[model samples]
Target: MASFKKTATGWRADVFKKGIRRSKTFRAKREAVAWSNQIEYEIEQGHHDTGAAPPNATMYHILERYRDDVSPKKRGARWEVTRLNQMMRDPLLADVKLSDVGPRHFSAWRDKRLKEVSGSTVNREFNLLTHACKLAWREWQWLKEHPMAGVSRPPENKPRDRVITDAEIESYVETSGFSFKTPPATVLSRVGAMFLFASETAMRGGEICKMKKTDIDFNKRVVYIPETKTGVPRWVPLSTKAIKILNHVLDYTKGTPTVFCVTASQRDALSRKIMKKAGLEGINFHDTRRTALTRLSQKFGPMELAKISGHQDLKILQSVYYAPDPSDLVEKLE
Candidate 1:
């Protein structure tokens, strides 16, 4: 049976048919009656379930269980754990019980969160929540069904392509030859050439920085990136321009195990220093790879760009593809 009554501060609606039921406070008698009516509707719709009280479960307890027991067994689990902890720090979902969590509660949380997040961010949090519920569904076996079983996450927003322009490239090559943009030594000037190498070779900074003479096959013009982002063994071909830039870097780093293996922020500082030094604007080292990918896609095809960029997805290259120049196309045709 459901009931509504006037209270000191407001009206109260209470339902008595479930094992774990909730009562809500309303400001007016009409509001309380409406809430009581909705409660009945929910119960009639079979949304309200009856079960024994859930064992004492807290937000932290679920996180610890998911992180250590479930997450560790999955690939890219560390990132999941990090995201979970960050989401937990949000006050909205912190106090809600895992057992009491329903599609309605999740929807309310999502609606509240839409004000503060991008579509992609909202989708990401929903995905994280879905993943946690999936783990619970597979392992816990205690829950009847995943709370987010039918929840609809927002569509991912289109992300900007990370392409760099030729003017930017020219500025970058000129700057890399100069003094270090940051502190300590003038050695950081290699940042400019580093950007050039990345642009020409599509080599990741970390991989190229760790490259040694033993790893290089100058005769073959192939740099073996023994480890890659996909955890698959792969090779990246060296272009003549890339060879020239790397040769310069090798001359500068004649005796070192790691070549320009500074922290990413330090690399950013070096780039800014070079950008300021060269009197050029809006160029960064990371942009070089994007530039290279974009240029390659225009000249060759998506497959070729994917081959060079180590991207398994051709759609990625297509997304960043800039139109080729007609004059340049005529020259290539000739």
Candidate 2:
């Protein structure tokens, strides 16, 4: 049961159920009614929590705990850590106490962040925050109710359909300081080989960086990927060109365990520098997957392409990766 009274400052609502009492003061009577009703409902459902979080516990602390205890177990730990660090820097979201945190803070944050970044970026952050809050509410019992339950996610930006060209690929490789005649010996040469190899193999930048020299089966023309974005291992068949590039990289970095000597971050930085030097715009390293899949589609059917690309969802494989030129389709139609 709940009761409300008009106070000098605002409306004060008090709820008592299951021998537990909760009270809150809101600026408006409607707000008080809403809060009291929610409390009563939670009590009836046996989900009410009268205690757990410390008096001064803030969203920052929850996020910090999540970063240390949860994020490291994920495959995208690097990205999650980076995003969580950025989130903690914002005082509006980080400093708010668990009891006082509500949808308004997140709504304000979303509005401000939309001005600086794309909707997709903010949505990713929202996902991380949502999961953190869920854990706090259900697993950690840090909040009486989910704070983010009332907040709506921002509209996602359209997916990237930017396709890379062969000429641009050649220019990117040439600008990366790798030469066909000379063996790949420098880090820049390895980056170049990574770029070319991405086009041939469609392996992600991280996967390429994590590639072990021992994983390559030259006899079978296949490379076994023990770790992947999908968390499932798959054997990616190597093309003749891919094998040649691997052999070139092997000749130089033989002492190292990994094929490519650069981390994903290093590959991204060097790739951006090379792309800028090549005068290319709007093409990212991941675009190589789209380009490679488009080229692979010319020879392999949907099932075979899915196998090679490690895409369990054929619809995603077709919609996102298999980008064919209209002119090429027309040529084939003739």
Candidate 3:
């Protein structure tokens, strides 16, 4: 049963049916009648949640669950946890009810975030909120609607298109002493081999840094990537030069299970030092991936390249890695 009555402040709609009792106050009598009708219909259809979330449960409560229970299991768990921690410290969003948050609230937050960070950085943070709200709706049933549905997203920044030249590669290897080195290795020899291997094998810096000796088979000329950004393991073929580079580092990485046995900071610092010695400006270590993929594209088709590069999306490989010279195309046309 449903009832609508005029109150001193507004019109009140009350529904008592199917073991559910709910009331809503509206400014207009017609609004009150409409709300009561909708409530009655929801009760009849058995689609209502009966308030899946407690009215007092704040956004902090929901984020805490996501941070502690969900994010820790993800590949980017640390990053997700960090983002949730930042959100928890926000006075405006931390205390807001999960059910009460709307597009306007998110829009205001986005505006504030824009002032502090670039559009792409803010967009990544916003993704956390969107994913959290979606999980709450699907798994927890705590949210009736995704709070991010109507919110506008920040525009993503364009991907870097920097090119690494072969001449620059020679300069880098020579300056950093990464080119050719005998055994009885130094840190320069080990990290230098890493740079050469990344350039030749088309492996990401992290993948190259985290490589295990067990994962490499010199007889087969293959490097098995046990884990990748796409969550798909892949086998990256090694060139003769790449194989030589690995062999050079085998003794250095012999005692440890890891190939490079270097922290990310150590690798990064060594890369910076190599760059300085090479007299190269604005070139990152990842440019080696682009350089390798671009060279491989000359010999392999899209599918083969994707397999070698561990790219699930052919479009990404084409756009990010394939930077062919226009003069080559012109020469081919001629």
Candidate 4:
């Protein structure tokens, strides 16, 4: 038999068979009735899988699950893993119940962290926590509710990300070509090739470093990014400039399987040196990713830009990569 009943908390439906019971909660009477009907039909179909969905799972466990099971499958696995490790170390989350965390905890954490970190950084933590709770609520049934439901992220904090502008790029080419650091005239070319290659490719620093002999296909004009943010492999086409750099690198490592090996810090130092030499102002290594998306979005829709960058959604791309909202109407009024 199927039955619907009202309780103080809300409404629920129960299905009974031989002293056994199955029930689900609802916020409305109509919903209760509909769910009751659905349960009865499911029973008739010989599928009864409802049980006491556990809600006492610790926050740490859910985060670990996401890191191990969910993150490694992403192209951003390296960065995601680092973020998860940092979250796991947070004192609030260390020995607490996932179910017990509420909006207060989330709000307090975000507010406090904002003082110490950039808003974009705070947003990353907030997003990470939200996803952890979502996995617990939806996939694991480990939480009665996701506490991050109403938690808002901090606004972006954009200090000039050090980027070598078009002017600087030309200066780098000029100085390296004629100056003392010029190419071996026997070995590969000198300076800016790696940086320019990276800028034009939009390939992440790590991706560029980890590239292999077999990854590039000159005729196809595509490089198979076998590992990506989604853990799903994807392909990114290379610009002619990017190809020229890769070919240059290949000449030096003719027998080696690894592409160019460069650390994030090393690249940063080189970029800073080049920026100083060219007398350019502001631009960061990661800004290349931004520059790529912004230019691409001009030609392709946000969706197409997202495809190249492996962003899960356009909103994220727009928030970070899109130019600031224009105010032409306000200007006209002024």
RMSD of each: 13.0, 11.8, 13.0, 14.5
Decreasing TM-score order of the candidates? 2, 3, 1, 4
**Candidate 1 lDDT (Cα, 0 to 1):** 0.65
- Please give the lDDT score for candidate 3: 0.79
What ranking emerges by lDDT with the best candidate at the front? 2, 3, 4, 1
Task: Rate residue 95 of model 4 by lDDT.
Answer: 48
**Superior by TM-score: candidate 2 or candidate 3:** 2
Which candidate's lDDT is highest? 2
Give candidate 2's total backbone clashes. Answer: 0
Candidate 3's TM-score: 0.74
Better of 3 and 4 by TM-score: 3
Model 4: per-residue Cα lDDT over 1-334, one tens digit each? 8777786557757666544455654689898888777667766665654432223446666676677668997766777878876776676764477647788777877888888889988887777778878877887676888788877778888644343457766675554342223332321123355556666766676676667879888999888888775666777878877787777666666676566555555655666676677666666556777766555555677676777777787777776655532463355468
Per-model CA lDDT versus the true structure? 0.65, 0.86, 0.79, 0.66
Instruction: Tell me the number of clashing residue pairs for each predicted model.
Output: 1, 0, 0, 15
Worst 10 residues of 2 by lDDT: 48-57
lDDT of 1 by residue, 1-334 (tens): 6677785557767766655454554679788778677767766777765532224444444554566557787655756777766665666665567667678867877887788788888887787777677766666654557877776787777655556767776766565653233332244666666677788776777666667667778899987877676676567778888787666666666676655545445666777877787777554566667767656655666676677677776666556433344576787787
Q: Which ten residues in a row have the lowest lDDT in candidate 1?
A: 178-187
TM-score of each: 0.63, 0.83, 0.74, 0.58
Regions of candidate 2 where Cα sits further than 4 Å from its true position: 1-52
Give model 1's TM-score versus the native structure: 0.63
Candidate 4: residue 293 lDDT (0-100): 58
Q: Which pairs, if any, clash in model 2? A: none
34-56 per-residue lDDT for model 3 (tens digits): 87887788778886556455346
